[model samples]
Target: KLQMTREEVLHDIAELTSYAKEHYSTVLFSAEDATRSDLNFLIKANQIAVENGATRINIPDTVGTITPNAFGYIVRKNYEALPKNVRIAVHCHNDFGLAVANTIAGFENGASEAQTTIIGLGERAGNASFEETAMSLYALYRIPMNINTRKIFPTAKLIESYCGGKIKIGRLQPLIGQNAFAHESGIHAHGMIKHARVYEPITPELIGIRRSDEVEQIVKQSIKLGKHTGGHALKAKLEDLGIHPTNEQFQKIFNHVKSFGDKGHEVMEEDFLAIVKDVMGELPEEEQYVKIDELTVLTGSVTPTSTVRLKIKNNGDQIEKTASSIGVGPVDASMKAIVKCFEPMSKVKLLEYNIDAITGGTDALGHVSIELMDLETNQIVQSSATHEDIVMSSVLALLKGLNKIMKDKNSKN
Candidate 1:
């Protein structure tokens, strides 16, 4: 979405306004890729748009790179640089999954208007989603957007047809998705069935969506479990099979999930729990367990090497073991080495990997998050970890994340 360097955007106001004057009623001028271009040029462009009678000047953060605070600052700075008569608008992309955050930031900074497609549909990742932005603005910020909340569904369908990706409907999805209204767990469903206000903060009808009868029938079938048996909450309970986790273990898994995000993947449950027990051996007692002994990784190639060594106190005796392996990369190698040493203990699998950088610098540490899906239960397990060396961070982070998933899973069991 670059505005400079492109003749179309640079000359859009001059050529498009004449066409609008003859036939169209309004002209929307967007300076795409505004975030990456020179700010001085943008100010001049904004002046031109207003001079050409453009009703709106749209500034888009196409890369999803700006934080909410930064977004607000950008809008405020740019708007101040522009002629007062030009109406500022915003179009945001969700590449970093922060479109909603950025949109709010724009409003707080100075934007009086926004352009959003239903379900956030657009190219590359998509624009700021209408449902998330509208509801967030209304519910969280108390911004008065006069658009009818009830029109969300039809609007989403209309945009979905023109766009490529599917707009999955559900409650877990925020506003208009299917699960947004259907309660399935025993405690949640019972409370919701009695008084929906107990679980649902907003009415389904408010977003122009209806709870599917089929989902309700499925809940009825789950009556044997009474109410707390389906959905993610129930799935979480099942993950906690029978175990208490140490604070260290918990932090480890939490870090892993964050690391997975860096790599652009969701965390699952099975791989999470399995890796926990895989590394630490029988759950740590109040004071009887040894800490992680040693981990070495050789990375940056099609194949990598990993070595792990651990020492544990058993029956007043110190026992030690080492494992090593070669795999796709350092991460895979390290995981294999750990498994080799801890085999016959339990099975583990990796479901997803995501990663993101904490800061923008060569020295900035990258956070890696992982999701391990439990094959038996079909539940998602999450963990996150970080390091300056992305690969090493990924391996250690995954191990820590794995530990957390297992610790939580065992606790519930």
Candidate 2:
């Protein structure tokens, strides 16, 4: 408050300085709401503080009402008016979401120190954020500090948890959000895959954060296949998954992706991977066996029943066979029926079956995995299939296992 005249304020400052000199080697004087104060009074107040042996003077934007330009001007004015030895510091609030900007402006204009809080936690909106301030200084302004940046994300996470989820770091938050280093658009992901700096301003490791295999998995999973998707991006994505397709196979996959895009369907990573598996599973006529021609299942209070028609090809000759079976469940019945169609060659036992939902919703993608043991050769193989239909996933998983077993047998012969 300007209730006291400038003379009274100076007198109080002189007394405080005399008292501080007796015990302390350094003193810091903070002028609250200095930004809103009259420029002449603010300058006089700071000068009085400095003249009274204050080693440092802090100008706080208590109400956070100053713009970057104004804050810079104020800092420069105070620096020129204060004693040469007195250091100037800035403490800014984020009421207008300009705290970081104002703080940086002050720094560029000769403020030696910036007062910030972790995750910008403070009264009202909060103070300038530590991560944002420190990162901006180092990355944007080329001003280095003694901060250990690698601990930034982990520290923010710890504080967030301690605050009971109040300190929410948004996905697009500059340095530490989940999507800060994540790429979703095909063009961006492709460029990022080739050269990370293309899309990312800085490497995650610069802040002591390491990108794990899960990061790549998430990037691949979040690929938004649409009109914006590029064939190069799709090819890069497949290669990232270690699945290299021939040019012909890639053209087919690319066409399929475009067809889905044309139909306004966004292809998910799981869906794309499923498509790749389906295409790669195709083989020459002689090598193809255990193909599902048609399948029908009936389930009710009575025992579940399934009828399967399979087309088996051996030595370039194809024959279709139909079989029916019953089980405690529809999936079990389907597997039984499929095995029955193979007769002597179907001497395989289902060792284990597992199903997981890949996505959430009524139309969620389902993944089914099965382990099968060929009794004749005692060869155990595992295979998995993903589809929107759980029943079809189970059947496809079993078929894949059977095909693997047949291939193994043929190789042995």
Candidate 3:
């Protein structure tokens, strides 16, 4: 399949490198599937390239099956056999979750450069993750890499946007995942309360996760009270929120959280706050930041359109606004109209709206879940509501998410 013999391949390398040297000041050569290729031939191919003027030789673990020890040996052999003037680079693939380890091994063995893709994008199995590898070298190995460490989170987000939903990075992914710094276990939360570094390998600030100026904000987000939560964990999180309660109030909240978690629900941040406020008698109707006066939508064989009357509180000053917009459906129209009144809100953009019918019938109750994200800070909030009218349900869930974002934003000021 190569379409050429060994002698012909070396001849082509010589011709290509010689020809490219005239125009390009730098010439890099790579032997495809070098790890699996015959070592002598690969070395000879690379030697011929350098003799003809190649400045760099890239060794690729094309099949992604090479072990770290084997990869280190290959890099070392190539580093020793190849001319001292040329730089050696390793291109590893994560077929076995060893791309990061292999790339680091190359550095530890002698390879001068690392070839990686953001989020480890590549064919089939991904290549070495630039963020993971660079962070490992910078943080774990203490290798002072020349990159703006703070931009790691944003750059990954930009790449995700470019992917356009094709490649979604899970929240549990290291370094950039939402839960990477989130502590969910009772013991982990207790340890985190004592010292961040006790559970977190690094501080959130090292990766630009400063969502608030208050340490309590950071602490509250990190400790997720869930099924594994204990009384101590609950107390720690409540104290972070500055909520001091009577023993009875504390017992009531604790039982509620345990019961909720017992039913397989990992209570979210907004839901947790609602629970605390309800128990504290602070859940006044007036506490709602935005309220809908009225919402009307017209559809059925026409452009789906809606209009709304809304009263929103801006810094304790009630403001009334009315607006209308057209959408693909009545639900979309109604939600947009509601969002219009809360216009000039924060950069919290609607990410997703999902609905599931709990029963199979025309009058089946539908549960709606909505996610809103602050584009600037990438903070996400989720809310849900169940109702017979799906449109109203979506609006309620979206508003809940928006209210959470508003409360969080306002808390900072």
Q: lDDT of each structure?
A: 0.63, 0.80, 0.80
Lowest lDDT sum, 10 consecutive residues, model 2, at 212-221
Which predicted model would earn the best TM-score?
A: 3
Which residues of candidate 1, in runs, are more than 4 Å off? 1-25, 157-171, 185-187, 211-413
Cα shift from native, residue 12, model 2 (Å) = 4.1
- Best model number under lDDT: 2
Clashes of 1: 72
lDDT of 1 by residue, 273-318 (tens): 4334433342344443333589888777446988888554444556
TM-score versus the correct structure, for each prediction: 0.46, 0.65, 0.67
| Model 3 stretches astray by more than 4 angstroms | 211-215, 281-413
Rank candidates, TM-score, best first: 3, 2, 1
Clashing pairs in 2: 150-207, 150-208
Q: For residues 243-354, write the lDDT of model 2, one tens digit per residue.
A: 8888777877777666655665556766677667766665544565779999999999888999999987654567898999999899889999998888657588899999
Predicted structure 1, TM vs. truth: 0.46
